[model samples]
Structures are given as C-alpha cells and as structure tokens.
Target: MRVYPEQLARQLNPLTPCYLIFGDDPWLVETSKAQICAAAKQQGFEEKVQLTQETGFNWHELQQEWQAMSLFASRRIIELTLPQAKPGTEGSQTLQSLLQQPNPDMLLIIQGPKLASEQTNSKWFKSLDSQGVYVPCITPEGPQFQRWLDARIKHFGLRLQADARAMLFALYEGNLLAADQAMQLLQLLSPEQPIGADELGHYFEDQSRFSVFQLTDALLGNKQDKAQHMLAQLHGEGTAMPILLWSLFKELTLLLQLKSAQAQGTGLNSLWSKHRIWDKRKPLYQAALERLTLPQIEHMLATASKLELMLKQQGVEDWTALSHLCLLFDPKAHKHLAHIELY
Candidate 1:
C-alpha cells in the first residue's frame, strides 16, 4: 500500500479509499497530491470536500463529513490536511475507523508535514499503511540534485551547457519552488539557443548579473586590477556567491592542467592540441603558468574546493571566502598569502 513519486503516474488506484501523502518538501508533496487528485477525478470523482486541522478543529466534523453523502454525486473526493501531522486520540481513531470500513463512494486523501518515526509506527499510520497508499517525498541533494535538474530540463524541452547548468544549480540548490520558477522564466526567454552563463545572466539578471566565463578569464589572466574590478562588479550586480566560486575553481583547474602538461615536458603545440585549447587563448594559459608555480595552483585549487564545501554547509553564510579567492591573484595583496599553502 506504499507508492513512490516516480510510480504515482502509473500505480495510482482510485479504488483505494485512503491516501496518506506527507513530506518536509512542500513542492514535492503538493505535486504528488495534485497527481493523485487528477487520477481520482479521471475515474469519476465529481465532488470535493476539504478539511484542515486547525486550532480548535473538531474531529467530529470529519466523522460527520465521512458519513454524509451528496445527492448530486455518487462519488466524492474528501481531502484532510494536517499542517502539523499530529492527529490526537479522537482524530487518530476516526482515521483508523474510516480505513477499517472501506468506502467505495468516498476517496479519502490525507496530507501533512513529516511525521516522527514513532508517529509513523502509530496505530492510525499502520492502518493507512496496510489499507491505504503512503507516499513520502524526499528532497534531492548533491549529485541527486543534478539528476533532478536534468530530468526537469528534459521535461521542459530545453538544453543547457555545463557552465549554465552549474549556475542554475547554484542559484536554486535547496529550493525546488525557486528552481521551477527559474525554469519557467528560461522557457519563456530562451526557447532556441543552448543556455550558457550569459543566457542565464540575461534572464536571471538579479541572480547572475555578470558572465561566469568572463570572471574565469579575468582570474586566469591575473590582471589584478581588472580582475578585482570585475569581481566587485559581479558582486554588486547581485551575482550568487556559488557561481563566483565555481568560476574561480574552473580557472584554477585549467591552470593546473597547463602546469602539469608543462612539467611533463609536453610541447606547447602538442599540449594545446591535446587539451583542445584554442589558439587565441593559448597566451592566457601560458601567461598564467608563468605567473603561478605548480604549488600555487594546487593551493588555490584547494582553497576553492574548501570554499565550495563551506557554501554547501547548512546555515553558514559568510561570502568573504569568495573575496579571499579574488585577492589571491592580487599582486599587491601579499598580507593574506600566509594562509595560502605553497604546495
């Protein structure tokens, strides 16, 4: 009597009198509930009665609604919502009793926030688990997030470059509602071109005001003044810190590649050809390699990776780490080098 989000489309049974949908993620919970409601409606559920557990709510009223019948419709969809997911003695007993005697005329749908482990083991929950359908909504994190975003992009019939996808994930990592809203905006704005950082910036100007590629290029060139100016401009333009950190990380990665190739005694032409580095941009990589030692590149990469972990940690909001990274390239800024490891 349990269903998954992926299986809901094919496995929904309108004949099942009760359904329990509960989760901490509001977007997933609501989306699953909508799908179930649609399935019920398709099977001739013509009437809907909604009930929410609020302050001073009467459980007896739910019992009354359960026993009541509509003259106009033979089948009804009854929705019971518990924001707190705590149905006291009377409500719990009532829910169990409703499940005990299955009603073919009435389809009962219950929704709520996450329940504690003990609450899930309660008599009422057990009854629903046995007779009704229980659906749990879990939020995606890390690699799971990328998979979810890829699926969503495919659903929208959209294409995105690697950098653009990183920007999108950075902007809406933990918030599904915000991600869906941004996707809707992208659908309206760029229906043809493959999405990159510029397109993401163009549409979501408020979040991605500056191009990530430009930031990366500036950092790689080590034009101290130009890099600082662009960094400040990007921050002022309301760019997300994650995108900035990502740009720095990418630049350091490319520099490390170049340094490694040079250390291996690879010819410049062969190195460029092997890595597919464009001709016009070869000087940028060569200049960066000359400016930064292999140890320096490794240290910068280490700091960038640490900053990424810091940003992902819950409830930690110090963006000075991003500023610290930009200062690493500043020739005039040596006071902070004590923290920079040589190797």
Candidate 2:
C-alpha cells in the first residue's frame, strides 16, 4: 500500500500488518516509527518490538527470527533499521530476500532514508508494496507544512496570528523538526498570548545559524558572501552535508517545478494552494524563478550531485569544491568561472 505523508496519521491503524517507513527527513522517519511502535503495542504486540540494525547483522538471522513462531504472543512487530544501506551492500541483498517472503505473524517496519535507485525497483520494494504498506515520510511542503504548524500550535491551545504563522514558516523553511522546536520555545516564552511576527523576530534575534530563511534571502539578493558564510558555518558545525544538500535541492527543485507550472498557465495562487506552498515561500519562489532559468537550476542540481560524490570519495576537503560552486552565484564574479571540472 502506497501512502502520502499527510494521510499517514489517519491511515495508520494498529492492526496493519507491515510498514515501510522511508524518507530523507529524520524527524518524519522517527515520528512514523514511533507511531507504528505505539500502535503495535496498543494491539498487544509490545513484547514483539524487535529492533535490528542492518550493519554487521547476519541477513539469515532476521529471516530466522521472522520465521520463528511467536511464543509470547499471537502477533509480533519487527522493526528493521538500516542506517547505512548503501547501494550494492549485503544489507540491501538481505532486505531484498526478506521483502520477498515476509512472515505473516510479524508486522515488519523497515525504516531508513531515501531508497537507492537500484533498491526502488528491487524485488523487496515490490514485495513490500504488494504485501504491506509503503508510507513515505517525506518532508511536508507548502500548505501541508502550514497546516501541520497550525495543528501543533492548536495542540497546545495556543494561538498565532496569520503573520506569525508566515514568519515561522519563513524561518523554518519547511523544516518540521526546527519549526516544532521553535513553536515549543515560543509557547514557553509567551504562554496564552497570541504570537506576532515581531515576537518571533525578537526571540530569534540572537540565535545563530541564521536559519534557512536567511539562506534564501541571501541567495535571492545575490549576496553570495552571506550564503557562503552560512554554508561554511553549517558545514563546520558538523551538520550532515546530505541533509543540507537535500534542503537546498528541494527548494530549487520546487522552484523549477513551479516555474514550469506557471508557464503552463497555472495561476500562482492555485499552484500555491495545490502544492501547499506557504505564503512566506511565495516571494522566495518568485525570486528564484525569475533569477534562475530551468537550465541553470538543472546545472546546479548536477553540480550538487557531483559535490556529493566528491565528498563521499575525497572526504572533508570537498568543502573547497563547494566554495568554488558558491562563487558561481556571486554577482560580482565572472560567470565563466561557473564551469566545474568533474573528477
């Protein structure tokens, strides 16, 4: 069963037999896993919470465990976590086989990041689709994210003005985890009071890391210096490079898509509502669409891919490559220098 992230809360049932929870967002992945575990326990499968890491574990061990009859209970929930399931790895092979013949008594929950290209079409993926549910905990976008935020505020019986919601949306850039934390902080800082954008700005005044909002502002304003500085700081602070890349890539990709949609005669308002684009992101998207052509966006994505490859192959010194890429967007710099020599 294929399911969207928004429908997850309603679709997830305690009696579901299996779940394949995978995505780029760690927060989404964790939340889905937690929900599944809680639901399973509620269904009297608490003792069957089997956790297994993919690394170093024998593939046969999982099969054996799954095949074994549940002595303690009539049903069980098996959670298999693959933290490092790179392509062509033994873990992937094991998962392939396990997906082929899932145990009836066990509700297997496979949790991990984006599936590798090869794994997406593998026998395991297909098997999971046919036999169980495949719920992608992808990052929320546009209106979905705003709705999520509003629900979060309402959950605590707090009220936020529309402008305040827009401010939070801009500040977090659809990063649910950060948005959730910020909301919690605001609740603590101003309980029972309606929050305005000014309150948010004042609260975040001294905070470092500028957040994704600042990154977008700098990029759109052609302030390459600030953009590079922010990137360096995020990298230096040991933030996962892939996660940052994903965020940036997602923004660019969405802009490119919106640009195409606009060209096809779709109204901005309709597109925004359809894609769930938040109000705060409308200006940023418009700016990006005007500034970067489709070819440029595609090239940037390619450059990002190459950068990721370099980082994985050559390690930390790849920051130089990133810095060079940043120079491509510098308004004062010669555009000719944008050409990157691939290794």
Candidate 3:
C-alpha cells in the first residue's frame, strides 16, 4: 500500500490502522503526516500521542501505551519519529509484534528519514507496509523543481513575475528548506504581492547546496547537465578545490581499475567485490565502463595528476580544469573541452 503525497487528498486510506511517512525533505514529510492526522481526527481519532526515538529508547513503552489506549476504549494516533530511520533488533521485533495485535482504536503513524534500498526489505518494514500506507516524500530535481516551485507559490497565495520565479529557482535550486523559508518570508511581508525580478534580490539570499557525492554520482551515471550544474554550485559554495579534485581523481582511479581489469579478461563482479561497491552503485560504474575506454580513463587520470600538481605549485584553483575533467566523462562534451583553457 504505497500512496504518493499529491494523491492524498482523495485516495487517502483513512481506514488503515497505520501510516508510514518518510523522506529527506522535512516539508514534504510533515505535510503528508498533517494530512493523515487531520483525516484521522475526523474519524474520531482525537487523542494524539507523540514519541520521538532518542538515545536509549524503550520499545516496550510503545506496546504499553497502545494497550493503555485500547483499555480506555479511546481512539488514538501514536506519532513515532525515528530520526535515523533505524530500528535495531529489539525495536524491529517490537514493531512486528505490534502488527499482530491490530487495535481498531489505535492509529499508528511512523515518520522518519528516507530509507535506503536495503532498509526497505527488513521484516518490520515489510510487515508495516503489508498493513499500512507508505508515503515516500522525495525532493524534486531539475524540471520537477520548477513544477514544485510553481505549486508552492500558488499554495502560498502569491504570484511571481516570470523572471522573479526563475531567480528563485536559481537561488534555491537544490535546497528546498531554504526555498520554503524564502516563500514564508515573502508571504509574511506582503500576502498576495506580485514579486518582481528586482524584489527577489531584496528578499532572498542564495541557498543552493550540492554535495561532492551528488556531483560524482551524476557524472558516473552520465547525467552531464546535472553534474555540470552541481559542479558550478559546488564552486559557488566555496568548496575547496583540492577536495573536489580528490573526489574526481578517486572516481577516475576506480574507473581506470575497472576498465583495465575488464580489458584483461577479468570479470566485473570480482573487481566490484574487491572494491566493496554497493549493489545500487554497480549500475553507475557499469554506465561509466560502457561510456569510457581504458585509454580514455587513463588519460583522465593523467589529467587529474597534472591539475593536482598545478594547484600545489601555483596556488591557483583552476575550476576550468576541473570542469574539463568532468566533461570528459561525457563523450559528447569531450570535444568541447578543447576550447576551455585548463591551467
């Protein structure tokens, strides 16, 4: 029973005894939970109990509290927050056991950070999904962010000039929380005010964020545009050039190992196992292997060495060199790199 946030207004499973909401975006996760809670309140589930998983959390307390609610014949919603989204062995057993004792009077809501692919298959997670509604709230990316921004603007009861909207997209592209806060400020300052491009600078600061892992993953997965944009964002955020170079160099070294091994009649699985590559990340490596040859990978590694040497000797951070190095991952962009002066 998986339900998306957008479909909650009409297709919300109000009759379910449990709801599991999880995501990296707090706004989306909180919004979905509030909607479910409101629906539960309408169905006489007026009593609410909130529990946050902290250090030395007692799993037994949950069972005891539910029993207390059942004993009083009172409908209740137990809102449990697992910050790390991890339930150890005992906690896992406790949740599974609770599923066996279905209480019509109790509505359980478990909210947490996004679960990894492997975490979703746990016994407790399976049990909860089998009997409850699972809503995964994910942050929008690329053009999806544009739609989300438009919807959010409408929801805030404000209109934006075309250039003003684009400016917000540029300023808060990767950071949703900051974007939401910016919207709140705008709504508070002048409800229903039509924001102009010039007003955007007065009201908001640049809050875009990108991680090195995101850029590397995008490059390996052949998402050239996203990787390019993330690189620019990282540079703008003042990420150390040495750190960025090291990450790219690491990926290049790994790819070189794979390409060299595969060329010498070695199986990819053996190399992957030796490298400790996670199953989910194997596809990204495979994409890189298919796109690049042994010589090309080796050339990129040599290029990285030159950039590292140049940075240490001259103390000049050459972002163009880094961009050219990244762009080489894309066969189409490889030719374009010749035009850029690399150090």
Candidate 4:
C-alpha cells in the first residue's frame, strides 16, 4: 500500500480502494490529489466526489457521508484534507474509525502536511498502510534529482546541453516542481533548439531578486550591493524569511558535501551523476566551493538557524538584523563579522 513518489505516475492502478497522499511538498501533494480525482471520475465517481477540509468541521458528518451508501451512483470518492490535526483530538478518533471501514466503491483520499510524530505510526496510519495505498509525494533529494530531471526532459522530447542542465539543477536545488516549470519555460523560449548554459542565464537574468541562482551567484561573486538590494526586495514582497534562509542553508550544505566528495578524488562526471548535479550547475558549485571556507559556511548556517528562531519568536520585526546577516556574505562586508555577532 506504500508507493514511492517516482513510481506514482506509472503505478497508479484504478483498482485501489483508498489513497492517503501526504507529504512536505505542497505542489506534489496537490498534483497527486488532482490526478487521483481525475482517475476517480474516469471510473464514474464524477458526481459523487465529496471534498472536505478538516478544520472546525463536525467529524460526525464525514463518518455519516462515508457510511451512507449511494442511491444512484455506483462509486464515490471522499477527499478529506486536514491542514492541521492536533494529536489525540476528536478528528484523529474519527479518522481512525473511518480507516477501519474500507469500501470497494468509495475511494477515500486523506491528505495533510508531514504527519505528526505520533500519528505517523498510529493505528489509523497503520490501517491505511495495510488497506489503502499511501503515496508519499516527498521532494527528490541530492543526486536522485538529476535522474528525475533526465526522465522529465526525455519525456518532453527535449535535450539540455550538459552545462545548461547543471545550471538548472543548481538554481532549482532539487525542487522538482520549480525545475519542471523552468524546463517548460525553456522549451517555450527555444522550441526547436537544445538549451545551453548561456541561454539559461539569459532566460533567468531578470530574476535577480527571486531566483535562487541569482542569489547564490551574488553571494559567490561577493557582490554585496546586489545581494543587499535583492534581499530588501524579497523582504518587501513579504516572502517568508525562513524560506530564503532554508534555501541558502540547503545550497551551502550541498556545496560543502560536494566539496568534500571532490576532495576525496571523486571524478567530476561521477560526482555530478551521484549528486544529481547537472552540467550547467558545475561552474556555480565549483565557484561556491572555492570561495567559501568551511568555517564561513558553518557560520552562515548557524546564522540562518538563529534568524529562523528569531522570526518565529513573538514581536521580532528585526528585518534590519536579518538584512545585516545576509549582507555579511557580501564581499564588501566580508570582514565585518565583529558587529554582526553583537546583533
């Protein structure tokens, strides 16, 4: 009843009784839900598709709906979405009971964010694991991501120059949905041509403030002015500070890992294939590895973690402090750590 994210597309059989699609990636979760619904409709559960959100709702109603047999329709699909379900609550009890009563004609689909610690191994989850299929729409990680991209490109009947593919992977950082969108965009921009690194840069040139690639480039190039400007713009746009920090932290961590792997005599091609590095991203990763010291990278991660905690704390509108942390990475402020520690 458990399925890998990669196999979801091909292994989805119409004969399953229920589906529990849950994960950290919002795009993957929603996409899978949509596909399941479409498949349900194809099986003639169109009019009987019932969707429910689990916040502030009467739990009994869902149980009742599930228990009630269809009068006209031969099949039904109930999609229950629990955005936030506290442990040991009435909702949890209801969910546990519902999982016990599996229906052949009723396709019950439940989804939520990364499951709670207790809920993951709960009897309810276990029941679903045994009876219903659970598709984890988790994001790809490290080198497995490149394989995913290669499959996607092949599916699209497109080819990316080695350098271009590497750059795309570096920029997207294993965010499959973003990479997919970028690939589609590249196809649109140059339909008949295989995209090269230069083309990739040109297409993403104006994305200085929003693009992770541009942000990384700015940091690596020690362009303090542009980095600060982009940080300010992102802040003003109300982009979650944690998201930015997380992305920066992830990229640095990857660079550190890749650097270590390379130091151990890993071949560039082998490393790229193993780490899922595309050809275009090699230059950026190489640049970052050369420019950042282990201590510096460690400090950046620690700063990012602290910033995340500060943002979560009450009444901490410390944008200036956050800005300072980001600006410290700027070449102009490379030696300015004395004042940063005070903040």
User: Which candidate achieves the best lDDT against the true structure?
Assistant: 3
Return the candidate ranking by lDDT, descending: 3, 1, 4, 2
Candidate topping TM-score: 3
Off by over 4 Å in 4: 53-55, 205-343
Residue-by-residue lDDT tens digits, candidate 1, 14-133? 457788888877778888889988888888888999999999999889887778877886688889998888898888898888866666778888998877788799998998888878
Off by over 4 Å in 3: 11-15, 70-74, 188-196, 217-229, 235-243, 254-296, 306-324, 327-343
The local lDDT score (0 to 100) that residue 216 gets in candidate 2 is 54
> How do the predictions measure up, each by TM-score?
0.60, 0.60, 0.75, 0.62
lDDT (Cα, tens digit) per residue for candidate 4, span 226-320 = 56766766776687766777777777678667767767877666777788887767786767676766666667667776777776775455677
Q: Rank the candidates by TM-score, best first.
A: 3, 4, 1, 2
lDDT of 3 by residue, 1-343 (tens): 7887877667454568788898987778888888988888788788888998899999889989777745456589899998988988988998899979978888889999888877789999999989988888887776888988888898898788999998899788767888988998999987877889898898776687778987899999888777888898899888999999889988999898888889899999899889989997999999999988777787778888889989999887888778888888986765666345455
Superposed model 2: Cα runs more than 4 Å off: 49-55, 86-104, 141-144, 188-191, 205-343
Give the per-residue lDDT digits (tens) of candidate 2, residues 28-101. 88877777778776666755545557446677677777777777767777777766434245555666666566
